[model samples]
Target: MQLMEVCVIAKCTYKSETIMFSVSSESSMVDILKTLCLRFRGLQLGCFTLRYSVPSYPSCFLETDSDLDLMRTFLLISNEKTVDILVKDLCGISEYSGDFCVNKELIACEKGESSCSSTVEDRNEFLGRSKRASAKPLLSNEWETYIHHVGQKFDGGAEEFRLKLCKYALEVGFNFLYAGNDKKRVVAVCSNKKLEGCSWRVYASRCEATGSFVIRTLNNVHTCAGRIRESKSKMMRSRVVSSLIVDRIRAKPELKPVEIIHEFKDYYGIDISYYHAWFGKELAKLDVHGDESKSFNELVWYTDAVKETNTGSLCTLDCEAGINRFRRFFVSFGGCIAGFQYCIPLLFIDATFLKSKYKGQLLCASGKNGNQGFYPLAFGVVDSETEENWTWFLQHLASILLPMGRVVTFFSDRNQGLLNAMGFVFPGWPHSYCYYHLKQNLISKYPKSGYGKLLQDRVINLFSRCAYAVTEEEFKVAMEELVIVGSSKVKAFISDLSRDHYANAFFKGMRYGEMANSLAESFNNWVGVFRDLPVLPLIEGIRQKLMVLNSQRRFEAEKWTTVLCPEMETRLCENAEAGRTWAVRRSNSTVFEVFADYSVMVDLEQRTCSCRLWQIDGFPCTHAVAAILAKRDSVYDYVECYYKTDFFRKAYESPIFPIPDIGKGLGSNGSAAVVCFRQLQRGQPEDHQQRGSKFLFVVVKVDGILNVGVDIGQAFNTRRF
Candidate 1:
C-alpha cells in the first residue's frame, strides 16, 4: 500500500498543536495513538481519541482499523489529498465539540490572501515566521554586536531571552522590568514607562509550532531624558554581571574586582559599585572553577587520581576525624622524586603564607639542578608553621630520601620551630643557615639611627668578607675589621652563633656555592598568583607548571652538544681565560703548584685546590684550570659529573601525568590511603597537639583505566599540559 501524509490536530484547554505523520493501509488506530503520544510529550495513549472531521458527514470517532480504512476510502472517493482529524481528551470535554463546519469559499479566500503574488509586506511577514522557526541562540562573542529588533526570535526559551534582553538594556543605556513574566509569555516595559511616559516595551510569547520564544511586538525608542545609570539600576544583578565576565575571569583568574569596575567604565560606559563587582567576580570564579567547599570533598578522589596517572606518586590527605573537614595535604610526584636523585645533594626549605579562605602555610622543599635551575622536591599545606607540622612533613620526606643512602645537607632561614624539627627528625644531618637572614638579624639588633647608614654598611661588608673567607687567617682579618667597625656587642653576637652553619670555610658539607635558601624563595614567587586559590586548584596549578617546565627543558636539552650545561660550560671557559698567564709547577702527576699573585696547590686526584674554590663549587677554579692546561687536559673532563648534560637529562626524564577532573564525575580506578587528624581548636598551643591515625595504602592498576575509570574524555585531552 502507498503511504499517505496526514495532519493530526491535538487540542486541549490550554493550547493546541498540529503534527504530521506518514501512514499506510496497514496502519491501525493503535499505531496512530502511539505516534501521537510520542510526538506530544506528557500525553498518554488511552487518554485521547482521534475523531474524523468533514463538512458534510457527522463528526465520529475513528475507533478501530476498519473505521480508519473507511475514512481513507471516503477521502479517496471525494478526490481529497488531505484528511483533517481531531484528538479529544477522554476525561475532560474538548472545546472543539459538536458539529465542525468548513466553509469552502472562506478557505479559498484565505488561500488567495496568502498567495505568492502578495504584497512585499505580507511576504516579509511570512519570511519572518520562517526565520523564527529556525532561530538559534546567540554565541558568547556575538553579544556585543547583537541588536534587539521587533519579531526577533530566541530558541533557548524565556530565561535566555530575558538574559539577552537585560544585556540589551544595559548596552542601549536603558533599564526595564518584566511587567508579566511566565513560562509561555513575557512582557517587559521601561522602568520609567509610567512616570516619565517612556514608550520602550517588548512582548514575547512561545510559538506553538516551533516551541521558541518570538518577539511579537517591540518598541525600541525611549523618550527618557538621559541613560539609566547601571549602578542605580535594579536589573544590574551580580548574576547578570557574572554572565558577562565569565570568559574574562576564566582566561585570567587573578583579575581583581577593581579592575573589573574600571573595565566596565572604560569599555561599556557604565559605572558599577565595588561590592557588586566583587560578588560578580566571585560568581565568575565559581563558574570557571567549581565551588571551593565542594573541592575539599573531592580531595579523596583527586589523591587517588594522582597516584593512578603518575605511578609511585605519594599523595596524602589529612582530615578531621568524624567531622571529615580538611586539615592538611602533602604531595610528592614520582617524576620529581626520581628526578631529584640527579640534582645536587642539597635542599632548600621554606614556608610561605597561603591567601585562601582558610588561611594556612605552604611548606616547600626545593633543590638546585645541574644548570642552577629550581627543582621542586615536595610540598605540603598545613594550618601553620609549627614544630609538629614540620616534623610530620620531614618524616614523610625521609621516606623518599633515606632509601638512597646519600647524605644530604639542608639550607633554610632561621625559624625556631623548623630548627627544632630538623634536630628531632634528622639528628645527624648537617644543616646550613641562610647568611642573608643572619645579616638581617645582626642589622635589626642595632638601631640604624645610632649606628648611621655608613657604619652599618661597613659592618655588613666586613661580616660578608668574614663569611666568604677561604682561610683561617683571612677569616681572622675580616672578623677583626668587623669588630673595629661596630663594637664589642657585635663580637659577642657573632660568638654566640655557630660558624659551621653560615661560614663557607668552616662548613662540614659541600654547599656547591649555595649560601642561602633562595631556591625556595624563587619557587614561592613563581606560584604567588595561585596562593589565593583553594587547596586542590593551588596544588593542581603547581603540578601543571612543573609538568610544562619538565617537558620544555627536556626538549631543549635534546639539542645540546656540549659536555656540561650551557651555564656551567660558560663558567669553565671564563675560569680557563683568567688563569692563562699563571705559572704552573708540577710536584707529581696529581699535585701541582700554580703561581699568580700568590702560589696555590691543585690536586687532580682529590679534585681540590688550596684556594678552596674548586672543591666548594664542584668545578675547576682559576688555579686548577691553569694546572689542567699545563697537563694538556680538557677542563670539561675535570668538571664534576653533576654538571654534565647526562645528569640534566636524567633530572627531567620522567613525566608528570595530568590529573582527571573530578567535576566530570569520573571515578578512581586505583586505591588510596587517607590519614585523618583532628585540628587543634582556637587558642590551643601546638606543643600539646596529638598525632593522627595513619593507614597503609595499596597500589592497584586496572586495564583501560584512562578510558573507563578516570577518563576526562575529549574535553581535557586537548588542553596543554
Candidate 2:
C-alpha cells in the first residue's frame, strides 16, 4: 500500500571510495541530492542538490511527488550543463513527504574509518588526532607553540595570528620555530643567514615563550628601531666589504692608474663633464647632521669647485656622515659646453688627504704646447706618498689625457713611486723631477758645506749654459764637492740625482724645467679672486673667471701681428723684392719674441721692453716686436699653447642619467580609465541603451557632429557614423 516502494542502494567503489546511499520512499530524488550536498560540505553533488534547495517545481514533475522530483532533478543536474540545470526548474518542489538520509557514514563502508585515520587523515581529523591538541605541556615543539602563545598573549587564535609574525621574520631572514607548552607557549627562532646587506654574525639558536594572544607584544619588538638595528648590522658588514674592494684595487700593481672620470654635482642631478653650470642653495650646512655626515648634492659639488678654485687650487671635500651617504636627486638633462673641445690639456692635478690641507700629501704637473703658455696639468690628494697614492694620481691623470698621447712629459718633486708611476704611464717620454726639488734636497743634506754652494753654482751654470754639457765629466766635476760630503743619504740622493736617466735626466738639457708646476700655482692665483660666497654668487663669480681666461687667450691668439711695425714692413718689402713671401728677422737686433706670438721691442739704449708678453709668459730678453723693428726674428713663435681653447675642452665630458623608480606596479583593480568608465555607466543606468561617452568614448567633429562607439571588450575598437 506504500505506493509499491523500492529502495535501490547502489553498492559501488570508485578508486577505493565507496558509493552507498539509502533512498527513502516518500522523499523525492531532489530531496536526497539536497540532503547529500548538505551532509558533505566539501563534496560537489552537482545541481541535484540545487533542485531541492530551491522552491518551485515543474507541474509535470509534481504529479510524481517527492522521490520522482528528486530523481528528475538529479538526472537534470548531473546529465545537463550547469546553465541548463537552472532552466530545468528555477524553483524547487513545494511539497515533500519525509526527509532523505544521505550521511557520509552511509558511503565508504568498505574502508574502515580506522584505515582512513591510519593512512591519510583529513585536516580537521588530523588537528583532532594530535592527542595533546588541547593538553598543556611543559615545552612546545614547533613555531605553532609560539604562535599559540602569541595569540593567547593577545587573547586571540594562534593559527590566524602566527602567520603574520612568521612572514615578517622570514622576510628579514629569520625562521620561527616552536618550543614551549600550550599553557605558556613561546614564539622563538634562530637566524644564521644574511639577507638585505646584513651579517648574521650573532648566530645562536634561541627561543621565546608567551601565553594566550601576543600580537602587540611581538609587533612592539619588530619596530622601526629593530629594522634600523638590523640594517646597521648589515651595513657594518658591507663597509668591510667595501674596504676589501679598495685594498684589492690597490694591490694590483699591474692595474692602470685611477682616472678622475667626471666632475660630480651637488644639487642638480645632471652630470656634465665638458661644459657645466649649476645652481644650488644652502639646503643645510656642511655638517647639519653631524661631523660624521658627508652627504652632498650636485650643486654642492659645483659650489665646492668654485670655492676651491678661489682658494688657490686647493679645497677640502665635504659631505654627510653616517654610512657615507651622498645626496639623491634626478638627472634632468646633460650636454657639453660649446667651447669645451678647445679647453682641457692645461689640467692641474693635486692630491690631498684629511690631515692639514698643506701637508697630508700632494702631487702636481704642468704642461705647455706650441701656442699655449704655462698651464696646470694634473694633481691628486692621497693619504701619503705611498706607491698606491702616487699610482692613483698618475693613473687618473693618464686617463684624462689618454687621447692626447704619451709623448707628454711630466715634472714633479722626485718621489720614488711618483717616478715609477710616471715611467709606467709614459714610458717613452721623459718624467723629470724638478730642479728646485733636487736643489732643495741637496741643500738639506749639506746646509753650510762649501760643496753644497759649489754644487748649486755648478748646477745653475749648466742649466744657464743654453746647451748640454760637452761631457758627462763636466757634471761630475760640478758635483765634485757634494760627492765628498759625509752623509750617505746625501750621497745616495746625489748619486740618484746624477743618474742622467732617473732624476737627472731633466738636468741634461731635457727641457724638464720648462714643464715645472709653478704655473699651476699661478692659475690658482687667478681663481682665488673669489672663493667664499653663497652658491649663486659663487657660480656667477666662476662664470666671470672663465670669461676672463677665455677672453685673454682669444685676444692673444689674434693680436700678435699688430705688435710688429715699420721694420717688419721694410723686411717684407725686401723679401718681396727677393721674391720671398715672408722674411726672417735677425737675432742680433734688440728684439725679443714675447708670449702669444707677440714681439716686444727693446731699445738697446733705453733698455726698456715694449710688450707685455714678456711679463705674462715669463720670457724676456727675446722680444719679437723689437726683433721685427731691427730686421730680426722673435722667440714668441715657440710660446706654449696652454692658452688655446682646444686644451680646455678635452678636460670635461661625463654623462649622467636618472635612476629609475622600481616600486610596486601601478593600478591593480583593472585599468584606471576602464574602472572610471564603468562607474560612470552605472550612474546613468536609465540610459543604458545609449552608447558613446556614456559607456566608453565619444568623438566629436569640429562642426559639432558626434561619432559614438562602444568598446564591447576590445579596448581600441571604434564605431562611428
**Best TM-score among the predictions, by candidate number:** 1
Q: What TM-score goes with each of the models?
A: 0.68, 0.32
Best by lDDT: 1
- Residue lDDT tens for model 1, 375-460: 89898988777788899888888888998788789999888788999999888788999988889978876668754767777888
Position 21, candidate 1: lDDT: 67
C-alpha lDDT of all candidate models, in order: 0.72, 0.34
Off by over 4 Å in 1: 1-162, 177-189, 193-235, 444-451, 488-496, 666-721
**Considering summed lDDT, which 10 consecutive residues are worst modelled in model 2?**
275-284
Segments in model 2 whose C-alpha atoms lie over 4 Å from true places = 1-292, 295-365, 369-374, 377-384, 448-473, 481-490, 501-516, 521-552, 555-721
Q: Write down the TM-score for model 2.
A: 0.32
